[model samples]
Structures are given as structure tokens and as C-alpha cells.
Target: MAVQSWTDMLKASKKTALIHDGKRKIHYLFKDGKEMAEEYDLETDELIVRKWRQKSTLGGQGQWQVEVGEQLASPVASSGSDVIKENCSNPVLTRKDTKTSFQWRIRNLPYPKDVFGVLVEASERCIVIKTSNKKYYKKFSIPDLDRSQLPLDCSAVSFTHANNTLIVSYKKPKEILTLEQELLQELKKLKGTAEGDIDCKTQ
Candidate 1:
């Protein structure tokens, strides 16, 4: 049967039923003419669904649904858009890179103080800036990087000037490697450097 027809059948059925599509089996539960939950075996199917019963003690009956491909096409479609509109209308603040090496800048500083330190490295959605005495790291996005990069794992970021490399001590080595690979890829695109010319070192 069609997906929508299946959804309608589940919504109308007050009693729970099991649906077998040959490849997988799905348990559908309904309560008061509304779909309540759907359980799927992971070994057969990759998708699972769940429904939360709103208790009066926790909160009154909340508006919830169990459906596939039903997404909020607009902000106002799901809920009021007052907050979303206000946030969207606000001007995006970004760091201005004077050297023209990268499109990076400091954001959210007080007025009349737009000066920022040099950009050391730009990583996945974050950038590292070297201050007079220390290195400040901030998120990679231009609008979110107001002051400095947020310290990960409390260890400050270190940069090697010899090869223009950034060193960050991460608890998980795999995450560090992934970030390094992304940075290398970005550098290649920006500098036109070949893969063989880029060297990444991990300690």
C-alpha cells in the first residue's frame, strides 16, 4: 500500500497492528483514533518511531504526531515565528580580515573597537587567532566568532610557525584527525596547494 494510506490506516485504527512489508516488520500502536507509536527491528529496518504520552502531571496533552516526510516547511507552520523572525532580521556580524588572506574576522566586540589579531588557522566552523600574549580560538563561522575560539578540553591551541601548522590536544584522536583533514582540504582549495605539498603532523 501507499505510504499515506498506511499512515491513514494507523491513525484510524484504535487497536495496535503489526505490518510486515516482507523486508521488515513494524508494530504500530494507536490510542483514541491517533497513532501512538511504531516499533521497528533494527536488524531488518533502519528506521524506528516512538510516541510520548502527555501525562496531566507532566503537562496537558501536547500536540505530537508520528508521520514520515511531514516537515515544517516554514517557521510559522510549526509554531509562532515572532522569535524566529526577530533573530533572522538581525544583521549578521562577521570578522573583517584586513590582510585578505582569509574571509575571517572578529565579531560581537563593543563599538569603536574593530581591531582583531591575525588569523592563524581556520578549522571546522572555527578559527584560531593569536593575541598579544596568548592564542584565542572561536567558532569557525564568521558571524559567531566575536572574541576568540572556544577552548576545547581546556588546552590552549598552539601553532607552529615553521610550517604554519596548528596543534590542538584533543581527547579523541579520531576527531582531531577528522578536523585536520578538513582543514587541509580547505587550505588546498584556497592556496591551490597539491595534496603532496600539504603535511599534517599529529602528536
Candidate 2:
């Protein structure tokens, strides 16, 4: 992406959920070094990106009001035969879960004219993204782990649009068991069996 200091606050909470205990979350967009927070509600599929305008009054502190902006949609979707062709950069992978079994999918990416690169960052809960160039940017939320059938975790996330196909893989866990731990288990098993079989000839 052609953004200057538009780093994503992946693990950080950019905007508070405005729904008041509703199933809404925060997505972020940074333009020209300024951060804009977008609130998305999963229940209603409604999105609102807001910009705060400061209004100063005489002999008083300035008041900040929420100014609603354009509705930006997530760039991920299913690929079809009629999809248009475009060039998208390779997906940046981040591992969410440490399990052995993997879950993944191929999606059709929507590339806006200003969208230069698709930045993907995955956590244990969801995958956050931002598609942007120099002048503009858009934020997306692709939940990696969801109980509902509508959205689920993708161990291997891939996207296809015309000639470009982006695939994202999960980082494997370092190791489940150490060599020393394995050897100790084997020794314990052997000792347990050796004690029980020593008097077998007496019978």
C-alpha cells in the first residue's frame, strides 16, 4: 500500500462498538497520516465510517461530532466465471490458530482504482485488512473463526480475480512435544512394564 504511517492497529481497538453491546466491531482506515474509525455491525451488515469534526466555541472547549462518510465494503468474495481481470499483490499471511487441521477458501477480490495492495493480518479471532494506495484507503474484516455458517475460519485463505489468485497460509505451530519430553515418556512406560513382568517366571 502507498500509505504513509497508515499502520494497522490489528490487536488494538481502534473504535469502540457504537451499538451498545451489539455485535458490532471496529475497522480502521488511515489517510494522509490521519486515522478514521469504521464501525461494522455483523448482525445487520451495516457499515459506517466516521470522521470527527472539532467545533470550537468562545470561552469553551471544542466539541467533536461524528461525521458519517462513505460505506466501504469488504473486498473478499466468491469467484465466478464473469469476474473481471485485475492484478492484486500476494496476500500477507498471519496465523490465527495453533491447531493441526487447516481451514481455508478462495475468494474473489474487488480492487478499486485507488487500491494498490491488499494488506492481510490475521489473529486468533479474525483477519483484518486494508486496501489502499496513496490518496485513499479501505478497511475490511474477514473473521477467521466464527461459529455461524455464514462466516467461518479459513486455514488457507485464497482470492481469485481474473488472472491473479492470492493464497494465504497459516503459520504452523513450532512443536507439540520436545525431544526430551518424548524420551522421558518412553522411559516411564518402559519402567512401568519392567516392574510388572520381572516375576513372570515364578508363575
Candidate 3:
């Protein structure tokens, strides 16, 4: 889907349903034999979990597969694969999450450390990265804070430049950590069955 018609798809989906679970809401729908489940924070209504599954080619029931669930530690990207686009290649942006911190890296930025500025826009609830040379600019927000209903903390945000990459990091809040742990447990309890269409809820 191109996203322009996502609303129409949502409207057209079969067996569309919503379930209230703790501080989160799970939405389920079926279309073309594929099922999608989304979990949103009831307070912010921000999506925290998304996953999809369909019929298994082998047998009876297909297991639920995650698309964008809780992020985990990722292997470092190879420098060869990071060279992406433009005559002057820009750093490929990547987000890496760990138990204690949320990190973002912009690769291929060859600028000096003094020329770059990383600022947390508290009112806007986003972090802005820009360069004095006007070569690059990026603005991103932390969905974990929004989903946990925690105020964005500028003091927790920091950055460093090394190996032609600008690394931005934010220490994870204790509340956010606890929320994730609880959410993971809750998610494990959700069961889905595809008889004719899909319906998912706590078993």
C-alpha cells in the first residue's frame, strides 16, 4: 500500500475489532487472508507494536510473526553497505536500541564535530540535528517516551562524532524500561486464531 489509501483499507477490512488491555489497545483486522495486529498506548494512542501473519504453506495454523515489535540490539552495519545515494553520499540513518539507551547513527557525515549541533526540541518533542555548513538536517522523535507517557528529557540526550558518523543517544528512563517489560509479558499472552478471518485477544 502507498499509504494514501490506508484509511480506505482500514475501513474495508473484515472483522475489524479492538480490545482494551491494561494501558494499551490492540486493534485487529483481516484482509486478503492476512491479519495485522497493532498495539497502541491508550493515553497517547501511539502505536507501540505492529505485526502480521498469514496462512502457513505447510499446515494448519501459521504462527504470529512480528513486523515492528520491541526493538532489540542489532549487529553493527558494515561500512561497505552504508554507502547510500547521492554524488556526495550521505550517512545512512539507523536506530539501535539496547536495554539502557536508545541510539541513532548517521553514517558518512565527514564534518568536524564543532560544525554539528544536536538539540532536543522539548516543546516539539523531537531531536533536531543540523550542521553549520548547511549540509545536513534531521528531526526525529522518541516514540518510547510518548508511549510511556513520560516527558522528554533533554538531560538524558547526548551525542558524539566518530568514524564519519554522528551518534545520538538517549538514556532510557526507568519508567520506560519497566513499561517495556510489562508490555512484553502482556504480548506473550495474546493469542490469535485464523479460522475464516482473524480474531486476536488474550486467551
Report the number of the highest-lDDT candidate: 3
TM-score of 1: 0.20
Instruction: Please estimate how well model 3 matches the true structure, expressed as its whole-model Cα lDDT.
Output: 0.68
Residue runs of model 3 more than 4 Å from their true location after superposition = 1-88, 187-203
lDDT (CA) for every model shown? 0.33, 0.34, 0.68
Write model 3 residue lDDT over 1-203, tens digit each, in one string: 44433434544655333445534435456566767776655555445566667788875557665544443334456658675535547566777555577788788999999999998899999899999999999998886576445688889988999999998989988877766566545544555332335544654
lDDT (Cα, 0-100) at 196 in candidate 3: 38
lDDT of 2 at 36: 42
Cα lDDT of candidate 1 equals 0.33
Model 3: number of backbone collisions:
1
Off by over 4 Å in 2: 1-103, 110-124, 133-164, 175-203
| Per-prediction TM-score | 0.20, 0.20, 0.52
Query: Each candidate: how many clashes?
Result: 10, 5, 1
Write the residue-wise lDDT of candidate 1 on 11-46 in tens digits. 344432344442122233444333344433324332
Residue pairs that clash (backbone atoms under 3 angstroms), model 3: 91-107
Candidate number that wins on TM-score, 1 or 3:
3
What local lDDT score does residue 85 receive in model 1, on the 0 to 100 scale? 48
Error of 1 at 189 (Å): 56
